[model samples]
Target: MLIFSVLAAAIAPGVALLAYFYWKDRYDTEPLSMVVKMFLTGVLIVLPIMIVQRGLMIWLGESPFAFSFIVSAGVEEFFKWFVLYHIIYNHTEFDEPYDGIVYATAVSLGFATLENVMYAFGEPATFGTLLVRALLPVSGHALFGVFMGYFMGRAKFQEGRKMRFFLWISFLFPFFWHGLYDFIMQSVPRSWIWLIVPFMFLLWYRGIRYVNRANSVSPFRLLKREEEVKS
Candidate 1:
């Protein structure tokens, strides 16, 4: 019973967050098949990320700066971006700007779900730890997903050198945000934990704004005119 409870605690928030992002797809929805496929891919990618992080730590030794930036932010974001760009970006279902947010959130939450489970059950587990992970770290991944998807959305419809630039930005921007989140928490004294609040607020604000902008420019919005002409 306790084991099951711990697993549920790890999983619930990730599901909730995944649902919230999927809800934002008001214009048109990607096929559930692709979404699930992307999600599973996200979960599977966690293994490689762990391996790489461990190897780095072994090579460089376990230190605050490395975990905060390189292993935590750099490795995770790089793989997420790589898989997202390689797999989902070119799919026909990625037909609009908003799809970027939707699919990206799916992938991000998938990763978050497994990550939460590990942290939750890998240790003794406590209400405070679960709550903090739910509200902060899990949600942070979704927010980073918003930023990534926003840029990838822009990149998807881009051409020439513009696409290249936007794609790089899509990856790096989230890497920076993730790094900043970890850096603040790890580097600062525990007494200064309160400092994370303003940063979280800013992240939430930017994520919401990005979602709106992505939705507003959805290529699906233009489908009406294309359909009208076809008729």
Candidate 2:
């Protein structure tokens, strides 16, 4: 059926991207149960996020900048950060830098999944809409999660002022990146559409670097080497 097909297409990109981040942990993988739970939490989080955004828009009166940055980017990333901070930041299973990416990706995809479904419902359920959601919002959130998780991983192991610094960075950086992305998409003149592609390239370039950095310094690599030495 067309409806079912639309739903599947809506869900696929976020799921695929989540899987990519999960297995990228060359040192250690998080338990499937925890990842799934984190994801569900993300799906559930959509309600509160929307409620707060609606209230804020009512108070502030909506504009393109506010909608792009504050309502869309700020509120969404803040809630995602709040949950990640409370839930996974200090977990024992979060044993390495890359676990940051793994957990964050799970939550991000969960949020993306429901968001895509809603978009599909509103539109006429076309392949073009599916492709647009996949290319932009879903994948953009994954990259944003990577940016947040990388810092949170460091914050986990750090001490004193360093830890505080990293924690704020984790929360703030994603908002900055997401806000920029959303702003470009919403506020730019149609004649400037050409600029959007390069901006996306910038985000992806930074995302790839963060992925590499997280992998390179994974605490699990050190721990595994220690175990092998004792053997």
Q: How accurate locally, in lDDT, is each candidate? A: 0.88, 0.87
Tens digits of lDDT, candidate 1, 164-183: 99999999999999998988
lDDT of 2 by residue, 179-227 (tens): 8888887777785458767877888899889989988987678888898
For every model in order, what is the number of clashing pairs?
0, 0
Residue 211 lDDT, candidate 2, scale 0-100: 89
The TM-score, computed over Cα atoms with residue i paired to residue i, of candidate 2 is 0.94
Model 1: lDDT equals 0.88
Angstrom error of the Cα, residue 80, model 2: value is 0.4
